[model samples]
Target: MPGREIINLQVGQAGNQVGESFWNALLLEHGLDQSGAYVGTNPLQTARLDVYFTEVAHTNSQSKYVPRSIQVDLEAGVCNRLKSGPLGKLFRPDTYVTGNSGAGNNWAKGFYTEGAELVDALMDATRLQTENADTLQGFQVIHSLGGGTGSGLGSLMLSKLREEYPDRMLATFSVLPSPKVSETVVEPYNAMLSIHQLLDSCDLTVCIDNEALYNITTGMLKIKQPGFSDLNGLISKVMCGVSTSLRFPGQLNGDLRKFCTNLIPFPRLHFLMPSYAPFHDARTQAWQGTSIPELTAALFDRKNLLVACDPRFGRYLTATAIFRGKIASREAEYAVHDLQKRNSHNFVEWIPDNISVSLVSVPPVGQKQAAIALANSTSIQEVFQRSLEGFSAMFKRRAFLHWYTEEGMDVMEFSEAESNTKDLIAEYQQYQEASADVDYEEEQEEQEEEGQAFEEEQQLI
Candidate 1:
C-alpha cells in the first residue's frame, strides 16, 4: 500500500520556531542540503520524504523541492525571519500565512476575532495543499497551548480541520507552559481552553512541558540557561524519534494509526508522555558504550521524560517503546523484558500485557542509537491538577477576566471551559482508580443493579 501524505500546520511564534528546527532535522536525516538537494546517497535513508514535502519543478533545470507545510502567525516577524533564513528555499512561498496583529496572549481574541478572520484564508491554503496529495493521511499541528496564537488560533484551526475532513486523523505536538515560570499571567486559561478543544477534536495530543525541557537541558544536556533554540532542538529530536516509524516502515506499529491504537486505549486518556534516551549536546559527554538494556532502563527515568511526572504514582494503561538505530530484535526483546520486570510494580494487575515494543532501524542523522518511550499512564493527572489549580486561583480572584471579555468572548465561555476541564480531570482520575484492580468490573455491575432496583422501587411507589 502507498504511504499516507501528511501536511504540517505550524502556528504562532513557538510553532514556527519549532517547525524550523524540525525541518532542519528532517533535512539532515535525509542527507539533504539547505536547498533540499540530496548531498549523499545513504543506503539506510528512507524514501518517505514525499509524504511530508513536495518536489516543485525548477524553472531553469527542472529540479525542485519544497515542504508541504503551512506556517501561520499573528505577527509577521517570525514568518518573515523564517522566509529569509537559510532554509527559506525549502518552503513554498505561498504556505506562509499571517495576520494583521498578534493575539496579545489573549485566547479569546485569537479564537474569536483573529481566528474568525483568518479561517477562510487558512482553509484556502490547506485545500490547495490537500489537492496535491494522492492519499491524504492527516495533519500534524505544532503549537504551544499557552499562547494566544498557538492555543486560541490553533484550537480554531483544529475545529475547522475536523469539520472539513472528518475522516482524517489530527494530531498535535502541544508545548505546555510551566506552572512555576510562566511568561503570561493568563497562560492557565489559554491552556485550558486549548485542551478542552483538543479533547473533542484531536485524535492524539503529544504534550511537551516547558519545565521538562528546562530540566533536560540543565541536567542531562548540561546547559546552564538554555535558550528557546536549545530547547526546540531537543524537542525536534523527540519529534524525529516519534516519526521514525511513520518515515520508515517496520515490522509493527509503523503507521500513525497503529501507533495511536497501541498508545491510546481510551479517547480522553490520550495525553502521551515521551522520554528520549542518549540526549547529547556540545557540553554533555558522549554516551560511551551504552548497552540496549541500559538505554531501555534510562527511558524509564523521570529526568529523561519530555513531560515531568512521577509514573510510579499511577498505573500504566498502555506503553510503547520505539527503538531506533543499530539494535537487534533479540536485544530489543530482552530490553523490553527487562523493562517489564523493572516496571512490574507500576503495571495494573488486570492487564500485564499492556506494554509493547517497536524497533525502527533508521536512526537520526548523527546518532548510533536512540529510544523513545510513549506511555498513556495515569500520572498525567498530576499535570492537569497543577494547571487546574493555577486556573482556579486566578479565576477565583477574577484576575485577567476583562482581557478576554474585551476580546468579545462571553464570560460564560470561561465557565464552560472550566467545567469541561474539571470533567476531564475527573475522568482521568476515574480511569486511574478503575485500573487499580480487576474488581472494578464487579463493583460497576453491583452499582448498576442497585440503581436499577431503586428505579423499580420508585416506579412501584
Candidate 2:
C-alpha cells in the first residue's frame, strides 16, 4: 500500500467526525482503506497523517461555532508503523482560554487571532523538520474555509501558511451556505472577502455552493425520505470528490467549474436584498459609479457559482464564462446569452432587463478555487460587439434565461451596483503591500473609511 500524508485542520464545532467521514468516503472511492493509525503500515502502506481540532464561540446564542484545530494522519499498520511522539501529539486537539466574544467591530481581528493559533501549532508540529527537513516534502496539506469557522478563522490560518511556504501547494475548499440557510447577508459577503484573501495565497480553491447542490441532490434523493441521506450525500460526494482531485498533482479543478460546465450553459447570478434595502430601486435602475465595485465583487471571481442572491431571492445575478482556460471572448458572450434566454422561456418572462458587468481577477494563493469576471474593451464598438455577440445568441437560444418570480413586496429591484474595478484592484494591491508590514491597523482603518463612505452614499441615494 502506498502511504500519503496530510495535515488537516478544522475550526469551530465542525469536528473530526465530519472530516473523517468525508475522508473515508474519498479513500473508499479510490479503492483504498483507511488505516486507523496515524502513520504508515506495510499491509496498507497507509498514508501517515495528523489531525487536530479547535472550537470557537458562536456569535449568536443559537449558533454553534467550533475552534480551529490541526492534525496529521498517516496510513499504516502493525510493524510498518513509525514511532509516534511529536507526530502523535500533533494530532491532538488543544483549547484556548479566550471567550472574548470578539467585539463586533473587530470581529475580523478576533478571527484572525484564532488562525494565528493554528499557525503556531503547525510550526510546533513541524519543528522536528528543521532537523529532519526531508520528512515532510512528500506530504500534502489540506484546510477548509467556510461558514464562521472556515471563512473567518480559516483565512487567518491559511494566510500564515502562505507566509511559511511560499512555494509549497496548499488546498482550501469552502462549502458556501445556501442562500435560504444563511441568516444574514453579511455572512456570505464576509465569506467572499475571506476567499479573496485565500485566493491570493493557495494553489487552487474549490467552492461548493450548498444551495445548488442541495437543489440538485434534494430533487434526486429527496431528503424527506428515510435513509435518503438526501443532500447530505451530495455534500459527502462533493467533499470526497474535491479531496481526491486535490490528491493528484496537476491543474486543480473546482466545483465552480463543474457548475459552469455541467449545469446550464449560463446560470443567472444576483445578490438578493431584504425589503429594508433603501436603495434597491435607485441602485438597480440608476447609473452610478460608486456601486460598481460591490456589483463586480459580488458577481465576478467565484468558482462553481451559478447565481448570487439571498434566501429571500430579493435580487438575482448569474455568471456567463470561465475567466481562465481555453474559453474565449466570443464564446463567453454566447454562453451568457444562452443562459439568459433559458431564464425567460416561460410565458411571463422575468429575466433581468439589464445585467451588470465588472472585471475581476484572483491570483493563485490562499485558495484552491476559481475566480471569474467580465471582459471589457477599449472602445464602445468593442463593448457593443461583445454585448451583441452575447445578446444575439441569448435571444436565439432562449434557454439562457429562466423565468421565475418572487411573491410579496419583500422582493425589490435595485439598480445593479457598479464597483470601480480599478479601485478593488488597488485595494487588493494595497492589502498585499500591507501584508508584509507588522502594523495592518492603519491600512484596515483606510478600508473601513472606504466602506463607511460607500454606506453613507447608499443612505444618501
Candidate 3:
C-alpha cells in the first residue's frame, strides 16, 4: 500500500468446473463479499451476479469437449465479478483482452465489431476506479495465459489495457503447465507469444507452475485423489503470498521493530517446488542415501538459491537432500565460475560463499484454507517463507512471442522449397518445370550425338 501499486486482470475461457473452483477459492481468500450477483452492465442492481463478460458462446464446436461463454458487464464491481458462479469457471480477463485470431478480429483485444466504442468507455472507468481507490492500499492483478480462453482472447484484452495506461505498473502472474504432461499444445505456444508481448508491457511477471506444485503436494499427502484440489490449494497459497507481500508487517523483513518500518523490495523470482516424494527415479527413495551428485546435476543453477521447508522432519529431509546435492556438483562449480567471470552471459548468478545464509520455515495452513493462510505467519517466518514462496513462484509464470518470423537471426530459416506449407501444392509445380527442363536438355544432347555419329560413320564408309 505504501509504495507498491497492483492492478488485477484475469481472462480465459468463460466456463469450466476448474475455473469455478479457482475463482471461488480466490474470492474467499480476498475476503470479497459475493452474496448478490447479477450479469450485464447494471451496477445499480446488486442482483446476485458479479462477473461481467463480453463474448457469449452460442454454437458449440464439435472438437471441443467443454462449453463456455464470457460477457463483460458495462458496469461490474471487482467483488461482483469474481463472485459470479459462471464467470469463476475458466474466465480469464487477460486473454479476453489481448488475444488475436490470426485473421482480422482481435476480439480479445477488448473491441468487437459492434462494440467498437466499448474501448474508450472501459479505459475511462478504469482510470476513475484507480483514482477512487486509496493509493496507500497497493493493488494486485491476476489473470491467465493460454489458448481458447487465456491464450487467444485474454491476450488481446491485455494489450488494450497497456495502451490506456503506459505508466502504470502491471504485475502478471501466469500459470504454466507441467513439462512432462503438456496436453495442450496450441495453448503453450500461443501463451508464450502472448507473454513475450506482455513482458515489455508489464513491470513484474510472476510464474506459477501448477504441475510441479500438484505433484509435490499430492506426494506429501500420499493421496491418490484428483489433482484439481492440489491446483486450487497452490493457487490459494500463491495469492495469499502475494497479498502478504503487498501488506505491511510482511514476510520479507525477519528482524523488525515490533511496529513495522520501511518497505522491502518485492521478490524478483519465485519457484514453487513440490515435495520430492515420488522420485521420478528409484534412486531417491533412501532419502539420506540418495546420491547428492545426481541431485546436484539436477538442481544446480548459477542464480541465488533460497530453500524453504515445512520445518517438520519429513519435509526437511527432502528439502535438505535437494539443497546439499545441488550445492555439491560439477554444475554448481561451473555456475560459480560463470558468475565470477565478468563477461559471462549467464542469466543466473552463482551463490556467494561469503554471504550469510538465511533460513525460514514455512507455516502450514489448514487443508482447505492453507493457500489463503500464507498471510498469517509471523515476521521471522514471513520474510524467508514469503520470499522463498515468491522465488518458487517464478516457474509458473510464462512469457511468449508477440510476433513470429521464420527469417529472424535466432530462428532457423528454410528455402522456398523447404518452407512449403503443403508439399503437394508446391511439389507438383516444381516437378512440372523440372521435368520439362530435363526433357529439353536430353533431346538436345541426343540429337547432337546422333549427328556426330552419323558424320563419323559416313566418313568411314
Candidate 4:
C-alpha cells in the first residue's frame, strides 16, 4: 500500500517560519537538496519520502519531489520569503496562499473579517493538494496562539477542516502564549478564544510554550541570545521525531490513527505535552553519551519538556515514546520499564503500562540516538489557568474591547470562552484527584448488605 499521506497546513507568520524549518529538516533526512532532488544513497531511509513528498518523474532517471503542504498567511511578507528562499522550488506555486492586509493583532478581525475573506482561497489550495495524495491520512496545522492571524485564522481553518473532513485526524502544533512573556497585551484573550474553539473542533492539539523554549535554548542549547529561528529549530525536530513512525518504518509501526488511539483515551482531553530528548550544546554534542536510559530520562525531565508545567503536580494518563537510531529493542524496553518503576507516582494508577516505546532505525541527520515523547498529562491544565488569569484581568477593565466588538463579535463570546476555559481546567483537576483503589469502599458496602440479610434470617428463626 502507498504511504498514508499527511497534508500540512502552516498558518500565519510563526507557522510559516516553523514550517520552513520542518521542510528543510526533512530535505536533509531524505538526502534531498533545496530543489528537491533526491541525492542520498540510503535506500532504506529515503524509501518512504512519499509520506510527505510527491514525486515528479523526469525524462531522465532522476525525479524531483515536492512537499505535500500549503503555506497560509494573512500578510504576504512571510510567504514571499519562503517562495524566494533556498527551498523555493521544492513547493508547488499554488501552495503559497496569502492575503493583502494584516490582522492587526486583533483576533476578531482574523476570525470574522479578514481571515474569513481569505479562507475560501486557502481552502481551495488545500483541496488541490489533497487531490494529489493516494491515501490522505489527515492534516497537521502549525501556528502560534499569541498572535492574531495564527490564533484567529488558525482556529477558523481548523473548524473548516473539521466540517469537511471529520474522519481524518486533525492535529495542531500550537505555540501557546507564555505566562511569563507578553508579546501583545491581548494575547491572553486571543489564546483563550482559540482554546475554546479547539476544544470542540480539533482532534488533537500539541501545546508548545514559548517560555519553555526560551528556557531550553538558554539552559540546554547554551545559546546566548535565542532568536525565533533558534526556538523554531527545536519545535521542528520534535515535529519530525513524533512523526518518525509514520514517515519511516519502525519496529512497532503506527499511523496517525494508532498514535491518537494510544495516547488519547477521551476526545475532550487531547492537548498533549511534548518533549524532545538528547539536547546537548552543539559544541559538546560529540562528547555527550546517547545511552537509552539517559535519553528516556531526559524526556521526562521538566527542563526538556516543551510546556512550562510540572508533571509532578499532574498525573500522566498515557505517554508514547518514539526512539530513533540503531538501538536494541531490549535496551529500549528495559529503559522504559525502569523509568516507570522509579516514577510510578507521576503516572495514573488506573492505566496499566502508560508508557509505550517505539523504535525507528533511521536516526536524524546529525545524531546517533534521539527520542521524542508525548504525554496526556493533567498538568497541562496549568497552561490554561495562566491564560485564564490574564484574560480575566484584562476583561475586568474591558481592555481593548472595542477592537473585537467592532468586528461583529458579541459581548457574550468573551464570557463563553472564559467559562469554557474554566470548565476545562476544572475537568483536569477532577481527574487528577480521582482514586482507583476501591477495595475498602466496596468491602464496607458488602458487609452492610450481609448484616441486613442475617437480621432477616434471625427473625425467621
Candidate 5:
C-alpha cells in the first residue's frame, strides 16, 4: 500500500515563515540539500520524502522534487521573498496564492472579502495536490490564530476542507500571539473567531505560544535578541518531532491519524502542547554523552516546553513521549517507568494507560539524541482564558467594532464567537474536574443519602 500523503497549507506571513523553516528541517532530516540532491547516504535514515514532494524530470536528465505544499498570503511581499529564498526550488511557482490588497489585520475583511474571492483558487490548488497523492491522508495547516489572513482565511479553508473532504483528517499547527506583547490590538477578536471555527471543524489543533517560543529562543537556544527566524526554527523542530513517525517507521504513531487517535480522546480537548529537548544548532555544539533518563527528564521541564503553561496543575488526558536518535528499547522502557513514577499525579484517573512511548532511531541532524513530549492537558485552558479576558476588555468598550461591522459581518457574530469560546472553556474545566481522583458526583449522592437517613431517624424519635 502507498504511504500516507499530507498536503501542507501555510497561510499569512507567520505561516509562510514557519513553513520555510519546516521545509528546511525536513530536507535536512532526509539528507537532501536545497537543490534536492542527496548529501548523505545513510541507509538507516529512511524518511518517506515522497509523501510531501513529487519528482519531475528536468531538461538535464535529472529529477527535480517540488513540495506538495500551498503558500497563501494576502500580501505579496512575503510570498515573493520566499520564492527568492534558498528553498524556492522545492515549491511549485503556481502554488503561490496572493490578493491585491492585504487584510490590514482585520479578520472580517480577510474572511468575508478576501477569503471568498480566493476560495475557488485555493481549492483548485488543493485539489491538484490531492490528486497527485496515491493515498491522500489530509492537510496540515500552519497559521497564526491571531492574525487576519492566518486566522480568518485559515478558518475559511478549514471549514471548506471539512465540507470537501469529510473522510480525511484535518490538523492545524496554530501559532498564538503573546498576551503581554502583541502586534495587533484586535488579535483576541481574530483568535476567538478562528478558535470557534477550529473547534467545529478540525480533528486536532497543536498550539504554539509566542511567549513560550520567545522564552525557548532566548533561554534555551541562548539567542540574545531572538527574531521571527529564530522562533520559526524552534517551531520547525517541534513540528519535526511530531512528524517523525509519519516520515519514518516506528513502533507507535507511524502516521498522522494514529498520532491524533492516541493523543485526543475528546474532540474539543485537542489542543496539544509540545516540548523538545537538547536544543542545538550549527553554531552550538551538541552535548555529548547524555543518558536517556536525563533526556526524558528534560522533556517534562517547563523551560523546555514550547507553550507557556503548567501541566502539573491541570490534568493530562493523554501524553506521549517520542524519542528520536540513539535510544535503545530497554532504555525507553526504563525511561517510561521513571516518567510514570514521577508524573503519576499528572494523569486522569479514568485512563489506565494514558501515557505512550514511541521510539525512532533517526536522530535529528547534528544531534546525538532528541526527545519530544506531546501532552493533551487542561493546562491549555489558561491560553483560552487569556484570549477571553482580552476579548472582553475590548468588547466591553465596543472597541474596533466598526472594522468588522463595516465588512458585512453582523454584530451578533461577535457575541456568537464569545459564546462558543465560553463553551470551550467550560468543556476544558469539566475535563479538569473529571480527571480528579475524588468523584464529586458520587460524594454529593452520599451526602444526600446521609441527610435522608438523619431525617428518618429524627421522625422515628
Candidate 6:
C-alpha cells in the first residue's frame, strides 16, 4: 500500500507529451528500467517507490511497478501514441481514456459539448486510482492553457476535482501561450478562461510559457530551433526537481501539502515562477560546479527563469528552494539567510524570512548537483496580463466569438473571466507594493485596540 500517494492526471496533448517525458525522468531517477522493473543498485530509491509507483509481485518474488497515473485527452490521437510508445507497458490499461471527437482548439467546444460528456468517465478512472492508495496525498495535473482540450476541458476537469476532493491539494503545471510561439488565433480567449478557473480551483500552479522555453533553448543551450520534445525535456527536469523532495527523503519538507504551504502566502496568490540552476548544454559542458551561494544567485537570475517575466520587476512574497545532491546543511542555511540580508529590497519587507529551503540527498540523474526554486513573486501576474491584453483586444472587436457561442456558451462568461483575471492582477499588485511602514501601521493599530479594551475594563471595575 502506498502512503502519501499522488495520483497524476495528465490532460490533453501537451499534458500527455510532457507527462511522458516526466515519467521517463522519474523512471531513470528511481533506477527502474523501461518495463518499470528495478534495475539499479541504489536500494534506497526503492524504499519510497510507493509514492508514485504500485508494485505487483509474481513468482520468484519478481515485482512489476506500474505508474499510479491517468492519461486522458478529448481526442484519441495522443493517448493512442502513449499506448504504443516505448514505456506503454508500464501503465495499466484502465488508466488510459479518450473520446472520439476532438476539442477542435475551441474552448467552448471542450467545456460544454465534448469535455462535459467525457468528465464522468474521467471521474470514474480517478476514483479507481484513489481507492487503490492506502493514503492519497493529492493530484498533480499537467496541461497547457493555449489549446482547447488543455484549457477548456482541463478547466472542466479541475472544477469537478475541486468539488469531489475539496480537502485534497490540487497542483498544476500550467503551460501558457507566448508571442514568440503563437499557436492559435483564439489562444488569448482559451488562456484567459483557463486562468479564471485556475484562480479558484488550483492550490498551486507552476507557470511556464513557450516564449521563455524558446529563449532558453536558443540562447543558453544553443539549440538552433527547439521543437516540442526539446522544450518538454526542460519542463520534465524542473518537474523532477520540484518532486525530488516528495519522492525521496528530505530534511525539512517531504510531502505535497507541506511544500504547498511553504510556497503559498495567500490562497489566491499560489502561482509560482520556477527556475533551475546551471544552464549548461550537455554537449558543450558536462555540468557547472555548484556552491550554495552561486546556486542561490542563479535561481534569482531572469535568464534562469522558466517564464518570460523578470523577477526584478516584482516583489517576491515567498519562495522555496529545493537543493539536490551533497549539500552541507550549515552552508545552505548560511547562504540563504545571508543572501536575503544583503538584497533586502528584492524581497517584500512585510513577510519576515519568506524563503523556505529543502534538501534532498539524491541528485538528479546525469548531474552532480541541481537546484530548483519556485518563487511566488508579484511578477507572475505579467503572464496573466499579456493574455488579458490579447483577450481584450479580440473581445472588443467580437472577433471569433461565434466559435465559442455556437457551442452554447454565454457571452457574459467572457466578461466574467476578464473581470476575475483583472482582480487577480490587482491583488498581486497590492501585495507587491506592501512596505515596512504598512506593517508598522497595522501593528500599531492592533496595539491601540488592545489598549482600549484594557482601559474600558479598568473603568468598568
Choose the strongest candidate by TM-score: 6
Candidate 6's clash total is 0
Q: lDDT score, residue 114, model 1? A: 81
Q: Candidates' TM-scores? A: 0.93, 0.40, 0.42, 0.95, 0.92, 0.97
Instruction: Give the backbone clash total of model 2.
Output: 92
Q: Roughly what TM-score does model 2 have, to 2 decimal places?
A: 0.40
Query: In candidate 1, what are the lDDT values of residues 368-449, reduced to their tens digit?
Result: 8889988888888888888888888998888999999987888777788889888877887777777444587788889999
Model 5: number of clashes? 0
Query: What overall lDDT goes with each candidate model?
Result: 0.85, 0.33, 0.33, 0.91, 0.86, 0.91
Regions of candidate 4 where Cα sits further than 4 Å from its true position: 439-461
Decide which is better by lDDT, 2 or 4.
Answer: 4
lDDT tens readout by residue for model 2, 1-461: 11123344433322222444454444443333333222212221122121111112334432211212344221112101212421232223332212223212121432444334444654565443322333222222333333344455556656766777665545544554444545443343334345445536554444444455444433433444423233334344444333332232223222222322322212111111111001112224344332222322333222222222221111122222222222233444544454445543311122233232111122122122222432110111221122233333433544212210111101111001012222333332332233323455777889999999999999999
Q: For model 4, state the Cα shift of residue 386 in Å.
A: 0.6
Error of 4 at 364 (Å): 1.1
Model 3 segments beyond 4 Å from truth? 1-5, 14-125, 136-139, 178-183, 227-229, 251-461
Cα error, candidate 1, residue 227 (Å): 0.9
lDDT tens digits, residues 1-461, model 6? 23589999999999999999999999999999888888888866887899899998857687889999999898899889998999888899999889998998999987899999999999999999999898888999999999999998899999999999999989999999996689898999999999989999999999999999999999999999898899999999999999888888788667889988788889999889999987887686744567789998888889999999988889889998888898898888788888888888889987888999888989998887888999999998898899999999999999999999999999999999999999999999998898889789999999999999999999999
Candidate 1: give the clashing pairs. none
Clash totals, every prediction:
0, 92, 76, 0, 0, 0
lDDT of 1 at 13: 93
Error of 2 at 416 (Å): 20
Clashing pairs in 5: none
In Å, residue 97's CA in model 5 sits off its true spot by 0.9
Name the lDDT value of residue 60 in candidate 5. Answer: 82
